[model samples]
Target: MIGSLDIAIICIYLLAVLAFGWMFYRKQTDASSFTRGNGRLPVWALSLSVFATFVSSISFLALPGNAFAKDWSSFVFSLSIPITAFLAVRFFVPLYRKINSDSAYAFLEERFGRWARIYASVCYLLTQLARMGAILYLLALPVNSLTGLGLEQIIVITGLLVLLYSTLGGIEAVVYTDAIQGILLISGAFLCLYFILSKIDGGFGGMWQEALQNHKLSLGSFAFDWKSSSFWLILFYGFFINLQNFGADQSYIQRYMSAKSVKDAQKTVWLGGLLYVPVSLLFFLIGTALWVYYFQNPLPEAIPADQVFPHFISTELPVGIKGLLIAAILSAGMSTLSTSVNSSATVLLTDIFKIETANSLRFLRTASAIMAACSIVAALLFLGVDSALDVWWALASIFSGGILGLFLLGLLVKKSAAKLAVSIGLVFVLWTSLSQMFPESPWAFTLHPNFVIIIGTTLIFAVGWLLRKKD
Candidate 1:
């Protein structure tokens, strides 16, 4: 039983989603309209869409947990993204534009061959399935705890609201919904920060300094420590991680692709980079504030540290304000979840199913239904994992590196055969998967599995290319 205010807030969110879907539905008469919002969006809209896509329900919970446990070192993984943002515009945009295809993987076929295109699409679909599953698990967290609802019940009810609106309206509806969710997402984070700060004796700055004194500000080791999850292995390969996430991940690239021009797309990427940095700082600040609040007013022993934010919201704020925060959490979850389902659908139609044969509305609806179903099932399964961020990083290791390799090879390694590119790139993905699962012995340098994936893929591709030339 949610508070009336929280229920109201959630209702507003869903209603807005439906109305926006209707507005965009009329404009989306054919497949292109369905896939890329008819390609008329401004850069600002695209940037906001990108931001909403990346900042999901997982972050709402995990960022605080990371701050509660780790410190500024919590952001070490963030070091890889700014670099990738720049690369996405310079390398990815031009190639994607030149190819003039609706799907990112379509470029591989135009440049390499049909097999290469199919290969890229399959990789994207598989990776996205895993990612979407994780997001569903994330959103379901609130549904479970907030209303005492079962996971399957929440999955069936709330998840349908997100999936159906997206399937009917396509990218157009998704972009509009995402833009509103973005503002709410940022506002919600800030609201949490204010509430946590207001309840504490001192403000955020004082608490932050207090946290530093307690060594809660640790950023972990900068030097590579394969055995330590907090060490520099992730940072070492952070640059390439940025590349693949922003450049090759269709979940992101599709936002840019929706822009009417390359310049518009580039601006969207830069704006997202600029704004996201500060918003993340606010999340970190909220975590530190909660750290202090807990010390002053101790929590129950059985409560997990990760639940600090929720506990505070439920207890500290007045019922109405608490309701707002609850809606905020749902906003964060729905924002990313909707984007994932929609992107997965787009990739299935244009990239995976290769529906390039027909540019009709019928093809678009058929693709959306098929792909959305797959995403819904995948998301339902991944929810069992307890740590939201852990799932994100593991998914990153499995696919991010390999996707980066294919895009880079397509963009820069001009003469590389498509079949060779797909074969070598997937081999790298397989190697990373194996390395993550096992090591030579107990003493083996246990690098950040993400580091292992990116480096493994790059090395494998270069060596494979050189070997083939020699032969």
Candidate 2:
């Protein structure tokens, strides 16, 4: 169990976050300010905010777990971010700024019509809800195990705290808090790495030798097998999926709009990408170090890889450091949850309802509350799920397919047909569902899970081009 000092540290951290958010409360006098902030945020701060928004509790908890359980295949996903962000800065950012709209899906409405916008918006909402739920569940798991708190209780406390700050301060609150959290999480990981390496017998050299001998250093299988994870498969999936994140995702586009100018937003994208690579490597290194640490000092009983990091935190680290690490985990969760709530509310008010009035602020706040509640419910629903990270990745791929497809169709296919785009999107959805449900079926067996988004996206563009005349 954590010491009283640790608990106090956690409480202080939570209160500080709430107070920081409350500082921005009075500035949210209208819907615009609430959703987009004052448009004066520093590029560096927004850059960190974007990084935090993307690197949620999943990265904090699951990335280490992944390295603990498997090799470095997943790190390839992080490698793909910078490439995708480059494309986003060059093309997507300017397009979004050109549209000058609050909602990311507004471009879809302009190009593919209202149905396309609504379809993409719904997908974005669902994706965000699932993501928020998984992040909350992952965050609650460690705290519940360490502090003797019920999982449900932890979820509610964390969710409500995030909701409070998000509702009170809006995007400014979310972004600024994210910047702080980003720093904390990164610092916490580096500190953990330091401690882990300090404990290893020969330090970095010993850890490397152990990892190499155990084959934990392998990137992934280089085979062309589609039934299992492979380097090419992950790299391909990472490239396209991250494209969805930067191109079609509201959370990122919202950040883009919050920037002072197009150049600032572009800088935010690139800088965030630059920061992510190293921070991600740090988390993966932590996992590898944990593997080596445990190899030297084995656990008495087997535990899930996901539980390994938290378990170490509870048993190994000194009290204050443990509290700080926990705070970092909570920071990750809150940063993501806050962003999810605010962005979902933005989409709800602007894309779905098209509300532009003095009352829009009230409606936006109400929507934010409603969205937070729904996310808590979703998080609770994910309580028993195994491999929270894998579940999140699969859900993200499935939900993002149609939205990504539509966006690609708009960008790549000239004379794009709305009806055909919608049809292609539905086909992608059906393919995803069938592929997921019957992975063993011959046709689905050959289709790698990682390639789902890539294939779906290609079909959307190809079919739209082929059927343009029909439309």
Candidate 3:
């Protein structure tokens, strides 16, 4: 059970973040400050913010859950980041900075047409919605398990607090808060690992031997398999997904713009992507450690895998430490949720409504509120998911898989690629629908759902390249 001291600590952390964010509310006098901070934020802060965005509570909770339930196979996804980060710095950074627009989809309109921009923007919104919803839902799981509080209530309260700060401080507030939150997130993970290690019999060496003995450290099969999540499959998915994130996602594009220069922005990408590699490995280690701990000491009740980590935190940790770790989890969710809300509002104002006036800030706040509400509702809908991490990955793949295709079609093909883009959309829709609806049907698209983006990206680029205008 949670003690008063723990509850007080959590409440104070929440209130402090809100008050800290409010200090920047006055600085958001325009859309640029609210959205990109007019490219004035330091690269270090921006980098940590980007890192926080990459690792949400989905990582904080679900990752440990995933490792506990399975092995370290999925860590390959993080392994793919360095390559994608290199590409982003080499190609995507200069391209977006040159475009110099608040919206990342601006070049799509210039290359293809308005429809292409709308298509990408809508896809981004859907992806963010899914991302936000999953983070919100996952954040609630541990809280509910620990405190016996209603998930819906936890989701709404947490959602609103994130909205308050994000709407008030805008991008500056979001970035700075994320920087602090990122540190807390990492520190909290380290503390958990240290405590877990202390409890183990042989410490690190014992845990390592145990993990290896159980085959829990293997990175999945190296054989070429498309129908299952093989190593190559995860690597491909991670590469394309990171490409979409660094190359095309509004959340990252805004971060790139928030830096002081193109060089700083490139550095942000490098630091953010590289930093996550080790931290994600740490998360996997924590999960594996939890498994060994539980295996050595079986539980009286079989809990959901996703709730195991929280169960540990609640049952095992000291009073104040539990609050601190809970705050870290909340920070993970808030940092990501706040980023999404701000970025979504930016896209809404700049891309959808095209509002850029004195009233732009008002519209952005309203849009942020609306996005928060929708995300909270979406969280409620995703409550019963078997695995929050898997659900998020699947949804992210479906919504964002083809976006990279459209972006590459524009970048690689000089001629008007509108027709090819439209064709890709039609095919993508058909492909996604068939894959999801008839995943097991041999007569239909039966490959692993993760392949959706890989196939879609290749199809769009290949088709557009082959049928390029004979200029």
Candidate 4:
């Protein structure tokens, strides 16, 4: 195991994050400050924050493993990012800003009523917990193997440290920490790419041939699933997941809200989307390189492919480079956690507490504290999940069906069909998801995950529109 240096670097990274949280704590005693940094942040700052919120540990570690095991077919999904950003910026961001609301779900209450608002808020809260928990669990895998810490202790300690600063400092703290984490993550990814290629003997072409010989370098990763992870199938599947972020997730929304204006929010999101393609490809490339590395030089024993990146980092890299890799892991874990903890509190206060409508600093503080506690508990429970990516997809898929309905209905549907549209839309998503979940699924529907959000959302809106017109 790569011992003390890795532990030292990670501990330093946490302290830096803590210092940032404290620096931003300019007495965030009210709801607005806690949720959104008083809406004074620059567009660039919020954009970077959005980027940080997404560059998660799962992406840091798992994306490469996935691509290595599979192929560039993952890029098919990566393409959905720019399109999703366009939807978020041009449509959803403006809609929420026009409502001038802190919580994205508040748009539900404005268009629908209190029940709808509560429903969306509750869903966002539950989903954020799931995401945060998955973040820690993924982090635990890397930290435990490298540092000899037990998974349970690592989970608790990681959860507590994140909850402490996030609860104390609020959105400003979250954004700053995320901004730093994002930069570190992006740089670290490319650095890892550079090092992996350097060691591969032949630069790019040589590595390519090695992967090709071993059935690793195929670009047609979708260019179809054998039941799971097919090439062309991933294209549509990736789009559905991206749409949920561009359309629904509160963490995504809250980052947009932090922007100086709607235009800034829109521009930032699209830019981030454009940025994702190249950055994401690096993950796949690293995966392929590792595959070649193993093919050319076999791992010591039955090392998990998921540990492929770590195996390279621990064994091949010099000591100082190993420290930097540990820091990259911090970049993955803390950035996402900071953004999530802030977003969760935003949902709790803005949507759940309805605090903006009232004046209660004490109430806001109390709510912040309660939200932090909930986040810790949520992370603990999330540690129990067996698979990170499946849970991540399921979460985004479920919430998206309804949120897509709300956004579409809000913008296009007339008053007569509004309530029915929402009702039918909810049922459509539920039924599709339920059918997809059953063991003996009928192939007649071809219940591929690619269509989960796309088909589920479209049918709900399109069918509801037809029925409403007839009525």
Candidate 5:
């Protein structure tokens, strides 16, 4: 169990986050500021916010778990970010900026129709809800195990705290807090690495030799198999998913539109993309070190990879440091959760309802609270999930399919027929639903989760183009 000092440290960190969020309360005068910020946040801060949002509690928990259980094949997903960011800055940023709307789905309405806008927005909302739930579950699982708190209790406490601040302060709070949390997340990972190395015999050299001998340093499989996690398959998946993240995801687009200018937004995207690679590598290294540490000093029995890091925290680290690390995990979860609540609310108000009332802020706050509640429910639903990373990727791939497909059809296919676009989108929706529901079915079993987005998006573009030509 964690000591009182550790609990106190965590409480203090939570309070500090609440206080930081409250600082922005006065600035949120309207829906625009509430959802998109003051439009003068520094490019660097926005960049850090982007990094934090992208990394989230999923990365905090899952990356280390991944390294401990598997290899660095997943690192390819992070590697593709820079490539996508470059394409986004060069092409997508200008287009989104030119449209100049708070909702990223606004362009869909103009390009396709109201149905397209609604379709894409609904997909995004579902995706965010699933993501929020998975993130909350991942965060609460370890904390609950470590502290002997009920999972539901942990979910409510953390969910409500994030809800309170996000409802009170809005997007400004989300971004600013994210910037602080981003640094803390990286620092915490670095501290873990340092501690692990200190305990290893002969330091870095010994650790490296151990890792090499055990083949823990393997990058991934290079075979072209679609039924398994091969390098090319992951790379292709990463390329498409990263494109969806930069080009279509609302959390990122909100930051892009919140910047002072298009150029500033573009800079923020590139800078955040560059920063992610090293930070991710650090987390993977920590996992590798954990593998070596345990090899030298084996546990009584094996624990789940996802539980290993938190188990180590509760048993190994001294009090204050353990608290700090716990706080870092909470910071990661809050940064992502708060952003989701605010952005989900933004989408609800702007795209779905089109509310323009005098009490817009009240409506927005209400929406934020409701979204937070829904995310908590979703998180609870995922309590039985085995692998946080796999479940998250599956949910992400399933939800992202229609929206990414629609976006590509709108952006690249000129003179698209509305019926054809809708048809293509429906095909993707049906494909994703069936694939997710019957993963063991022969047709679906061969289509890895990693390739879902790529295949769905490509199918939409290809079919939509052919239909457009016929039209």
Candidate 6:
């Protein structure tokens, strides 16, 4: 059972988050201030917000779980971030800053027709909902393990806390709180790694030897195969998906708009994007160290990879420290959830409902409440899932809908790529159905699931190219 000291620490952390959120409730006097902080936020805060949003509970728990169970294959996916960051800083940041709209899909409407904007907006909303649900479900795992609470109950508590802060402070609260949570989680990660290393026999050397012997450091196959999550395949998937995130996702574009200037916004991309590389390495090392520690000290029975870290936290850590670390895990989920809630509300007001400024704040809050409720239901539905991280990656890729391709076609080709919208949509639906529904059928998509976004984006570009008209 979790000690009272630890539980108190967690409660304090939760209340502190709410207090911080309330501090900003008054500043969000208008829709612009609520959504993007009126472009007055410092680069450092925006950068940290981006970093915090990118590193969710998925990274906090899933990366270590993945490294412990399999290898560092998924780390290759993160490796593609710098490349995409470069593209974002060069092309995407400037584009969004130039457009200067709260909604990134506004650019799509400008280039394509209104249908293109709505389609992309709907895709983003669905993706955020799924993403939030998975994070909330993952957050419940450790809390349930520690406190004996049902997953459903834990989901409601945390979901409501996140909703409270997000709905109150809007994006400003979300960003600043994200910075605070980002710092807490990273500190917690470092502490966990220290304890994990100290527990092993030879410390870092022993852990390194065991990882080498067991091949935990492998980055998966480097072959040209598309049917597996090879290094190249993950790189491709990560690059395109990260592009869609930096270039097309409202969650990110909002950060761009929140920065003080275009230069600061561009710099935020590099700082936030590159910062994850080292941080991810640290998490992977934690996984490798845990593997070594368990090798020296075996569990009574095998558990799922996703549960290994949580189990360790629940069973092994010291009392007060355990609570702090748990708070870190909670911070991961809450920061990401808060960001998604605020951004999804922004999308609803700016793109879907087209609300006037007079009623935008009211609409954003109501929309956020509805989104939070739906996310809680989705979290409850996700109970008993084997791996939240894997499920999230697959769903995110499938629902991405080649938004990056359409963005590129509109920007580069300078044609009314809107004409290819129906064709692209059909291709997306057909490919998704075959890949997901009939994986065993001969006609099903045979390539690795990560290739869904890659193939969809490629087809969009190809169809648009063929249908292009001269300027």
Per-residue lDDT tens digits of candidate 3, residues 47-160? 999999988999999999999999999999999899999999999999999999999999999988788888889989999999999999999987886788999999999999
In model 2, the Cα lDDT at residue 111 comes to: 82
Worst 10 residues of 2 by lDDT: 443-452
For candidate 6, write residues 1-471 as lDDT tens digits: 699999999999999999999999999898999999999999899989999998898899988998988889989888889989998999999988999899999988988779889988998998998999999988888898899998899999999998898999999999999999999999999999999998999999989998999999999898989777788988888899888888899999999999999899998999988888889888899888888899999999988888888888999889998899999999889999999999999999999999988999999989988888888988887788787888888888777777777888888887745556546655775666576777887767666667778888888877887778787
TM-score of every candidate relative to the true structure? 0.91, 0.96, 0.97, 0.89, 0.96, 0.98
Per-residue CA lDDT of model 4 for 1-471, tens digit only, reads 675775677678888878877876776866777777777877666777777776788788777877666666656778778777777776778877777767787776766688777876776676676777777777677666666778788877877777777766788888777777778888888888888888787878888887777776555554245346566666666765677677677787776777788888887787666766777778888899888877778777875555677767777777666777778876788778867767766776667766544564445545555665565665566554545655666666666545565556556765435566666767766666676677366632335554566666676567656755532
Error of 2 at 453 (Å): 1.3
Q: How many backbone clashes does candidate 4 have?
A: 6
Candidate 4 ranges with C-alpha deviation above 4 Å: 3-5, 213-228, 356-387, 399-401, 416-438, 441-446, 469-471
Runs in model 5 lying further than 4 Å from the true structure: 432-436, 439-445, 469-471
Candidate 4 local lDDT, residue 181: 78
User: What is the clash count for each candidate, in the order shown?
Assistant: 4, 0, 0, 6, 0, 0
Residue 122 in candidate 1 has what lDDT? 70
lDDT per prediction? Answer: 0.69, 0.87, 0.90, 0.71, 0.85, 0.88
Winner on lDDT (1 vs 4): 4
Looking at model 6, residue 425 earns an lDDT score of 54
RMSD of 5: 1.8
Maximum-lDDT candidate: 3
Superposition TM-score, candidate 4 onto the true structure: 0.89
Give per-residue lDDT, candidate 4, residue 178: 74
TM-score of 6: 0.98
Ranking by lDDT: 3, 6, 2, 5, 4, 1
Residue 230 shift from truth in candidate 2, angstroms: 0.6
Cα lDDT of candidate 4 equals 0.71
